[model samples]
Target: MLLAHDDEGSGPAVVLLHAGVADRRMWDAITPALAHTFRVIRPDLRGFGETPMPAEEYADADDVDALLASLGVTDAAVVGSSFGGRVAMELAMLHPARVSSLVLLCAAYRGLEPTESVRTFGAEEDRLLEAGDVGGAVDLNVRTFLGPEAGVAARELLTQMQRRAFDVQIAADQAVPGPAPRRVEVDPTAIAVPTLTVSGAHDLDHFRSVARHLAEQIPGAEHVELEWAGHLPAMERPDAVLALLLDVLRDDPTVHAP
Candidate 1:
């Protein structure tokens, strides 16, 4: 399938993948800085943004590989947020040669088993969406995914983005049916690529858990926690996130240094 993408800058290739509810547009805050040093390729994932879905059930890794191939990118470092991070993990495992490195933010992995809060929230959101209460779904998403300190304007923008995300999913003929689920188990030790896992200090506990798991299990993997941020640190703390990303790309030994 042909994927929709936005490419910028001119240097070593780097692909930025967005979270499930957000499209490639989520990278708008930090892409400019990254573009200064690398060729940035941002693609709207299937059922999200302008990207149309494939005819058959296709893994996200396959879509990513196809996208890079189409762009004539033989190798690249990948930066993925949330759902996109999960896809990056799969790509690192399935096609390590194409991926030069990996950076994951507020990524979800581990397993399908959810905590009590996650379960309750998921059920409620599903019920609201099923009852045609899209507004409620948007509100719940904003409150849950974003930090409480987020400004009203930011929350509204998030809601709008979510609405557009839902519309895109609905428009896709091959969108995944039913509720989105997580992997049963993710063995970071199986990943061969150099990896960097990042999480917001105020993010849900699951993200921290995943980051810790990756840091400990994946060889040479590094983990960083951003204070005063939640699930979307790249949005909430763009400067810090960009600095960390650049340090990782430059292979700086002391990334946390001020």
Candidate 2:
């Protein structure tokens, strides 16, 4: 399937892959600015946004390639947050010819051991679900993902998105062909595309490790930790994140013509 997406603007393409906690709407805050100079495509990953959870086994990277191909885009810069970031890396490794650049935000990778706080939060969230406390689970996400200093609006936005996710995936049932097999672990060194890894200064240690590892493993990949942000820096500080994105895009050799 092509997947539900918002495609706009015109120029060298730039796809916005959203965080796991939120969907395509998560890019609403900054899409307008991005649209001025780039063809921005934001898609709701399978089972996440307006897209229905499928009953068959599927590769997300395949879905992404399908979406881009359907749009006639041969290559583009990809920016992703959290799980979306993981997807971005997979795209670069699997379809190097189609990825011009990568901008990853707090992306997790295979064999990534969660930090103590993340582990605690995950167990607590699972317990909440088992206890049928959806609201409580949403609250837990706000506290766990958003930093302590995050303002009320950020908290509320996260609460709304998290609750929406529960309303969709939790309320629905999905069946895979069999056991949901994990994709082969991507070889980071195989990603020759220019990459930028961004994390929040206040983000979880697990994601911090992700940013560091990506930078160290992917030759010439840039890494930065934005101040006053947590896991979802795009939402918490959209302007700052947008500026960084513009900087990377403008300087990318792939983005400019020879």
Q: Which candidate is the best by TM-score?
A: 2
Q: Candidate 1: lDDT over CA atoms?
A: 0.79
Runs in model 1 deviating more than 4 A are 110-112, 171-186
Q: Write the per-residue lDDT of candidate 2 for residues 169-247, one digit (tens) a residue.
A: 7755433333232495678888898898887779888889889888999988878777677898888877877877887
Question: Candidate 1 residues 1-258, lDDT tens each?
Answer: 767899999999999988876788778878998999999999988777787554456667877888898889998999888888888888787677789999988887855456677778889989998898888888888888887556665666677778888776655533556334223235687878888888887888777777777788889897878777788776666677788889988889887542
- Predictions in order: lDDT: 0.79, 0.83
Q: How many backbone clashes does candidate 2 have?
A: 0
Clashing pairs in 1: none
